[model samples]
Target: MSNDDAYDNSGHIPDAASYPPRWEAEALAFRHALGPRAVTNWSYGDNVRQVFDLFMPEDPPKGLMVFIHGGYWRRFEPGIWSAFAQGGLDAGWAVVMPGYTLAPEARISRITREIVQALSFMAETVPGPIRLSGHSAGGHLVARMLCGDAMLPAAVAARIEGCVPISPLGDLRPLIDTAMNADLGLTEREAAGESPTLLGRGLDVPVTVWVGGAERPAFVDQARGLAAAWGAPCEIVEGRHHFDVIDDLKDRDSALMRAILG
Candidate 1:
């Protein structure tokens, strides 16, 4: 079997089937708990998918923290991730979660651009230092935002305080021949272009890579490799899986939240 086959996560994580209903339940509960303070369907682009929701703290915000949801650039919704905003909100930081058009319908490159647009919009609207965090493919997108060739303006790029790519897909080349790439439609050029590990080293902003200790080997390797390549620190959350690792973001005092703040 190829490295692509070996690194394929859907094949390795059995609990992948449970994410939606579980996330949906949490999202619904968050809506009930927060009420109108959780703003929904704020448009960033003309497309219906280019929308984001914002969760604000009662007091003035310290900064903006954007959490990008992961579905391998294919599935998941921002609504399902609204509950994760609790930590940032409690920290006196405003949290934004943006939704994007999924793969097959939109290429990875375009999705990257969409995220840039979302961040740019948020940067203009929020007007403060920004911290980015994401899980799985969303982690890939967060890391991609730091790429040297990224489309963000010089001023906007400077506003990026740090990034936390949780359980990120740092190296996309491994997915070219994997089952995961079918919908991603990644070519050699696209994979290399999107892969943060291949994008050079020592970024201007600090980065922290987070991965679940109980996650698949490929995910561990991706997190470790990206940290080593960029000279960033990698935090392994012991006993957490691909899904459970991100749950730490919901706890304001958790290491994951601290990392995001840093």
Candidate 2:
């Protein structure tokens, strides 16, 4: 089936908007509760405008999991989702969250490059294997980071053990037809290039695609498409939605988290 046919969001736009308020509030609370850590800033380019926050563990971690926040490459920043690190921390994993120049200001290609640069920096500075994870738009970015034209350094790529993209948009063409694409300015070619499914499988690394059982059908289908394309496993988180699925990462027994850390 065509992407649009497979993942229809015709009636759930309003529900998608309302999914995040509680999660956002929880994230804010976590941000305030955590003690200070060494914050480092790295720039990809003048126009690209990329920055990442590295939350170092009080003790060294066995590996690092870099999280790319989802905002359709238009809205939201890394700071809002920093609470996610707690899950990694419990698993002895350090976390890196990066912010990229949003759409309308920078194109998708530039944003993708910025993510590559951010990952490159982390690979060089942070010692150990790396796993990638993100939610919604961030989830899409993580999948892109694993596909063709991946700008990651050979060393970093080698050290990447797995990917966990939660409720990702595996394909971008559908967004092109939606109101959300207004700022993205995604041409047909750009959409195809940005799509992980269209690009084919390039990484041998294991990938775990997770979505909330409560999420819009489109998101669940998006996760499934990526899993099918990459020959990875697709998981549905019980009673979760696009906004709250990441919260499961905080629970050690969460199926989504287990797939990621495994």
Candidate 3:
């Protein structure tokens, strides 16, 4: 599928999966290449629903980058995206990838709470300011954290220096009309509560919204809406799509990486 087709209001998942074949292959390869020593699982709650993984650097790190993976808040896990750590690690940054309970099993509110708990664990266990980033569904979670909620525990909120959310779905109203809501089960009230566009106006922290140039127009619109609502900067990664845009992070000189590190 083409980028334009992916964003069509067809209300279908298969329609929006136009990520480049090479990107998907690389992501899968990276998931398989993870070394045992580089990844360690950490639990935020009593059971499996609270688990996360820390991707450590070979040398002492300059700062921490917490990555939240994307699967429309239903599928995927931290393990599948561990390969993303290579970019941050090479740049002397530690990476933390966390997983939250999927919808149907848990509500959006609970998922948000689990993210907070995961970050709290990181604050208590890891050192230094944290730079947050996420893709798609994960993007919304990271953006929501920028609200600097005292509920997160003051210390954790204070250590969050910046946030970067790529191809984020900031508004939830449209999802209610789309077939995607089958698993989300988002009522109007719950959808409003979870939308970053609605929650971002009160946020005081710095944020950079990014979208791949080749991403669906809806994704681009989502990024634009978030940046406009928050009064922050929005960046477009040239010739990239929802998936390949993340590869730019591996290159320190890439504009998206510069925005994150800047």
Candidate 4:
């Protein structure tokens, strides 16, 4: 195997090819069920991909839960992950899944900023505290928001009650040598600058770094490194791998929901 193979989650998992079609079907059914409550294509920027899908709970929302989809910053969109918002929605929170320009089109730095814009818009549209959660590269984006360089409004920053970056890529330096960097287009400088691990202390909010015990060792190290940098809690769920680790996003009673909704 190649040196960068350690970052390859799909290759490590059997039947990985089935995940996309499954997600698409589940997300479609979820949107169909929500009907009007699932607000689609709310734009935060002029770009088509800058839009987000919001899923509101039946009762008044407890707050907002933003789940950013992760595909190494170069794949997937908000709609495909709609089903994942059910956990937050079930918890009486308005859940949002934002789409940003992917790598090869927009730099990771810009994607990070776009999420900030998405959160700011969500803050204006939804009242109450904000909870941030993302899987993989998306986890990197949510963590980036807490960095001072993100420049979130004091009010918006203050409302962020917690962040859970699941199986996150906390550091980017290693990617420079990986094969995906061709599409990621990350220079050494860009990787270092974009790494949440190298950035200064984040906003004063609760943080949890969660990874699957069965995930790639590199990912486990990334979670540990991130938690160490922020002095936060790190959760390693046994028997779970990268793809299945975020499944709890659709379950209200799951530990993931308690961390996000609390």
- Computed on alpha carbons, the lDDT of every model, listed in order, comes to 0.88, 0.77, 0.76, 0.91
lDDT of 4 at 22: 97
lDDT over C-alpha atoms for residue 75 of model 4 = 96
Of the pair 2 and 4, which is ahead by TM-score?
A: 4
Of 1 and 4, the candidate ahead on TM-score is: 4
| Candidate 3 Cα errors over 4 Å, as ranges | 1-37, 148-150, 201-203
The alpha-carbon lDDT assigned to residue 62 of candidate 4 equals 91
* Candidate 2 accuracy as TM-score: 0.88
lDDT of 3 at 257: 64
Better of 2 and 3 by lDDT: 2
Q: What is the lDDT of residue 256 in candidate 3?
A: 66
Candidate 1 RMSD to the real structure: 1.6
Model 2 residue pairs with clashes? 70-138
- Which ranking of candidates, highest TM-score first? 4, 1, 2, 3
Reference-based lDDT, residue 185, model 1:
93
lDDT of 3 by residue, 167-226 (tens): 888987667765557788989998888898987644466799999877777888999999
Q: For every model shown, what is its TM-score relative to the native structure?
A: 0.95, 0.88, 0.86, 0.98
lDDT of predicted model 1: 0.88
